[model samples]
Target: MKPKKNPELEIGRNSSLYFAIGLNLMLFLSWQALEYKTYDKDFVAIDILNVDEELEEDIPIVNINTPPPPPPPPPVVVETITIVEDVEDVEETIIESTEANQNDAVEERIVDVSDVDVEEVDEDVEVPFAAIEDVPVFPGCEGEPRNKMKDCFQKKIQEHVVKNFRYPELATEMGIQGRVSVIFVIDSKGFTTKVRSRGPDKILEKEAERIISLLPKMTPGKQRGRSVKVSYAVPIFFKLQTS
Candidate 1:
């Protein structure tokens, strides 16, 4: 014998629509039950009948004839105070200045501060060539007198510049002739660094910079017995030779 369940199988095929319809019907029933409220019809009818009533006012008529107000009260009397001047003169008080007194203890009172911070100064910093106690020494400048070392250093620098001086072909061809200020810093390690040049033309400045950079390393400058950097500036003139 074959088993048949056509009614239950057909209901399960589209169960979602039926479930939605039941949910809507349940919501509608709940809303109707929650919205159900009863009011006292007779009490509301009684409140409508108890409206406020207008009262009739009693206005009294007065006579036009009236006696004028009583006259104002008498004016008050004020007694004036007259000051009596005395013929005797008042003595002036003179205050003597303390500047003539030598009170040293009061002037030199010590003030102690609670908190003080000590800062550490960098000792390896660079001093300029003029301010340095000992300048950078060239190879042969060591044998010179201590006082004459400064002169020897300048002389050696001039000699080195004369030997390496070369006119840039570009600058010469363009007729760019001007005095260039070439600045360079001799580091603590006695090496030339931070070479900068400024002049009327860039070509002249570049030439001056090349000459300064080619300088050989020397002994580092000393300030207070410690090695320091020295800044050096020189002016290089590029004069065109007119035939």
Candidate 2:
């Protein structure tokens, strides 16, 4: 049984028509779903809002800080002095000082400083004594007529030696060693005068004078048959050669 195929029911021809219909339906539904999702995400309810309504709301406020005022400047101080005394008292004090100085000068002038005199006192020089000499008994003194005066001279000379002669003990004790020479005039009256030192030591000279002063007057020396006062020299030796 093979039946004849209808033209209208051909699979190939009807398949095209069914496919177009399905495509149209699927497109329409997809479009409608996309529109719905877009509208839901973006839409707002403007009709429910009340723009004119006044409502109280709490708002937070932030306060800014201000620095405190600077400290006050330090105080300024001033001092005052009052001088009450007059200058006249100071002037009087100065005048009194000057007057005192002038009065002191006038008093000094009245003092007699110039009237004082310094007297010079003269000093007495003590003449030191002389040394005694050892002499041999003078020869012609005993034999001649002039020898009559010998005894008198001997006593007088002894007295003179005792009174005027001084030993030079200092030289001997001090170990002083030297020679002293003396020059003197033997007068006609047999006295030694003007005794003076002719040697180095003046200390010995004094000693030499003491010795010469004790000498018995010498017989006047004859020169050209005339008796004349003669100058004579004597040397005294002081030594410690023994020790």
Candidate 3:
């Protein structure tokens, strides 16, 4: 037998629709509750000022007593000038010129070469090692040939440097090592002078200079058959050996 109640009006059929509407309404209420903000009741109270009431301030007036202006300056007195007449006669001075005129005779004197004194100035000439005609002779290298004198000189210099080279204690301890270029001048007297050195440190330079100063006296280099000063440069290397 068919049921008499209509299927469209059945309560169970509309239950899903009502449940969905109630779920949406519940979600909206939950969102509103989450979004609601609550302020603290312990807030600072601000006082409202009434614009109808006026504020009166009492300002005292001060009286300034200034000194009177200084009296006007006194009038300047003018002195009367008197005129005097000269009774004595004055003489005028005349300056005479000592300049020679065209009519004056000039005497001509002859200058003799014997009457004049000539001074001979000895100039100090410096010749470079490479450009010198004769290289300075070391004490032991005096027997070297003229053409081999340069090589002999260089060999002697190297031997001297090796014999006298001493590394500075300070430099060694501080690990300062470099090549020191020593520039020295061999004067006409064969003595080494004006020794200067440049290096990474002053200690190395001082050591190089000390070594150069110990060089033995040599025969002065010559240019044009005349003994002159010779300028030579040598580089002393400072190296630290690692074991």
Candidate 4:
């Protein structure tokens, strides 16, 4: 009365299950064959970046075996031709040369002296005697009882400057340094007359003249025991120490 079991149907199911498992295995092996591929070992060409288009440079070669050329020769010199003088002129020339030789012979003969006496002259030579005796004269002071005329002149000038001499203020400012040579004639009374600057600056000359003018009468210079007026030169120096 219950539902009957299907034995035939169960057998059929078992067979179908085994057949499905085998089919699944075959499908897996087919997929592995298609998915996992291997390549052949033949030579293959590969694509790469191209970069071989640049031009190459060439170098120049130099030769160092060549030698330099020789220099040019020097210039030639010509012989000079001289003209001969007339024979008559040459004869005259010989005669003149002979005459010159005779004159030279005479001079040589005169110079050669075996018989002549040679004496060494003494060192003493006679000096020229002047009628006038040289004496230092002082002017008006001729009879002033002064024996030292030169000394008096020097002293008088020195005294006059020492007492009243003042250096030129302008010259001192300008820095003038030199000796002024002044020539003056002393009268019989020792007064300076005709004062002139013989050398150097005009300013110095004027100052020297002023100085000589201020001097008193001096003893006159004497020549041969006579009181004679003398030309005296005095050198006045004006040197400024601080310019």
For candidate 1, the per-residue lDDT at 48 reads 47
lDDT of 4 by residue, 96-186 (tens): 3334544454434454577879896533221111221333433433443444544654665666666766688877877766888877776
Task: For model 4, give the RMSD to the true fold.
Answer: 17.4
Error of 4 at 122 (Å): 43
Off by over 4 Å in 3: 1-102, 143-145, 223-227
Using lDDT as the yardstick, the better of models 1 and 4 is: 1
Q: What is the lDDT of residue 179 in candidate 1?
A: 89
- Tell me, by TM-score, which candidate is best: 3
Q: All candidates' TM-scores?
A: 0.50, 0.31, 0.58, 0.37
Q: Between prediction 1 and prediction 3, which has the larger TM-score? A: 3
Model 3: number of backbone collisions: 0
Residue-level lDDT for 100 in candidate 1: 52
Whose lDDT is higher: candidate 1's or candidate 2's?
1
Candidate 3 to truth, TM? 0.58
TM-score of 1: 0.50
lDDT (10s digit) by residue, model 2, range 1-243:
999988767577678889999999999999998887445756765666558977889887866686878999988777789988885654344433444554465434555877889896543221212211212123245443434444543554446545765557876666555767777665444456778875555666677777777676555443333344455565666556583
What's model 2's overall lDDT? 0.57
> lDDT score, residue 163, model 2?
70
Tens digit per residue, CA lDDT, model 3, 108-204 = 9999999999996767999889999998899898787999999989998999999998888898899999999999999988999999999999999
Over 4 Å off in model 4, which ranges?
1-147
